[model samples]
Every structure is written in C-alpha cells, then in structure tokens.
Target: MPKRTIVLSLKDQDIEKFLEYITQRLRGSDYSLTYKDGRIYLTIHGRPREIEDLIRSARKAHGDFMKIHKPVAGVRRYPKDWLVERSRGISLSLLIRA
Candidate 1:
C-alpha cells in the first residue's frame, strides 16, 4: 500500500534535507517526493509499522534537536502523543530544525 505524507516548508534546502533524513533512516522503504505550491507530497510504499517508526524517529530527532538548540519563543513544542495523533495515518508536516 502507498501512504501519502505532506510537509509544509518554505525553503527547498529544508525539504531536501528532510528527504535525505527520511531516506537515510528508512532505507528499505520506497519514496516518491514532490513539491507543489508550499507543501511537499511524499508517497511511500511501505508497511504501517514503517510509517509509525518513521514518525516516532522524527519525534525523537525533533526532541534531540530542541534539547540542543532550544526552541524559539512562541514556537509550540508538541507532546509525544500529540505528534503520534497528528500523524493521522502517516500524513503530517515535518518539524525541521532551523
């Protein structure tokens, strides 16, 4: 089955890094990434477990980044469970560290 994920970002470099991050982590999964307007559409042909793993990994990475960089003022840091809930069947906008 193919799962679609949407990522909203302004910079192409960020999107590129996001794709590189995902590709490096999920080596076994196949991905088709494209950008339309201001959002990135990524289609992955992988298992449900893989999707969950990807989201979980992203959450961890975000947490680690926050620990080092400290989130900017007014930036909301979502709870772990909220991140999982927001996945909504593997569809979400990535929180990239800037």
Candidate 2:
C-alpha cells in the first residue's frame, strides 16, 4: 500500500497526551508519528478506511486543536531517512517566527 501523511498543528503541551491516545489506538497497526516545529506528522501505511478511521479518532479526541490548525495544502511522502533529516532541520525558532 502507498503511504499517506497528515499534518496537524497543535500545542506542544498536548503532544504527550495525543501521542498516548494515538499509540494506544494504533496498537496493532502500522503507523509513524513525529513532531516538528509544533506540528504533528502522522503517516499511515494502510488502506483508506484505516486512514479515515485514524483521522476520525483524532478529531474526536482533539477537535478544538484540529479546528484551529491550518488545513494541510498537500501531503507528500518522503523517504523515511529523509523525513528524519527534514523534520530535524526545522528549528523551533524558525517556527516561532512563522
């Protein structure tokens, strides 16, 4: 299956709780989660149904934060190695200014 990604802008404080919830829900599924510059990046390597399910669950759990997030214009899947490098390169200071 082709990989898919979702980017969500939220408070840094909420990350731990969000991660716990998502990790629990995706216990038996294949997914990747990362944080960069106050944005949460989730990648699910699965079917459309699974992806929708995950998003729906997230919305229910974090609707307020989701509503305030900038809608993702486009989502492109980069290689795993590149993802790590790219996200790491995004500094908090740059994000604060943006």
- How much lDDT does each candidate structure score? 0.55, 0.65
TM-score of each: 0.44, 0.54
| Residues 7-75, model 1: lDDT tens digits | 534354455555554566556656666787756665555688877676565545444434333456856
List per-candidate RMSD values in Å: 11.1, 15.1
Q: Which residue pairs show collisions in model 1?
A: none
List model 2 lDDT by residue over 17-94, tens digit each.
777755764678778878999988878787888878877665554553343332556533333333344467786456
Candidate 2, which ten residues in sequence have the lowest lDDT sum? 75-84
On the 0 to 100 scale, the lDDT of residue 71 in model 1 is: 50
| lDDT, candidate 2, at 1 | 92
Lowest lDDT 10-residue stretch of candidate 1 = 61-70
Alpha carbon lDDT at 39, candidate 1: 62
